[model samples]
Target: MAFDSLSAFLAMGGHGVYVWAAWGVTGLLLVGVVIHARAERRALLRDLRRRARRAQYHGASGAAAPPISHQEGRARES
Candidate 1:
């Protein structure tokens, strides 16, 4: 409504370049954040799965050592 026509709206009284550039940069950054988050999530899940498999393999073979509690560790250190 404020703009008379499509071309005039796009021109934005000669300030369109700056306004559109800002919008483009903001959009790109938002997209990059989304992509990075997804990649991190996938890597975390893959690492967890790998750890689980390793634990399972060790446990099945009776080679996995039992986890020590903090108290036990301190006693051993002393």
Candidate 2:
């Protein structure tokens, strides 16, 4: 082993603090990214499901839902 002991390996020749801090920050950021991505995916799926239900309801009534682009344009104008 390059390090004589476990303590020495962890200490990293007096640079342990900086090295460990960097590793901790990297781990935290990776976890945050995964969590954010999952939340975004869930939100997108929920929005899609809601839109499908709305379309089905409108179709059953023989009324067509407005095109997404037109709705978006009207919303923007408002």
**TM-scores for the candidates:** 0.61, 0.59
Candidate 2 yields a Cα-based lDDT of 0.76
Q: What is the lDDT of residue 16 in candidate 1?
A: 97
Off by over 4 Å in 1: 60-78
Give the per-residue lDDT of model 2 (tens digit) for 1-78: 889999998999999999999999999999999999999789668756776797787676424543335443356322
Error of 2 at 26 (Å): 1.6
Candidate achieving the largest TM-score: 1
lDDT of each: 0.75, 0.76
Question: Any idea what lDDT model 1 has?
Answer: 0.75
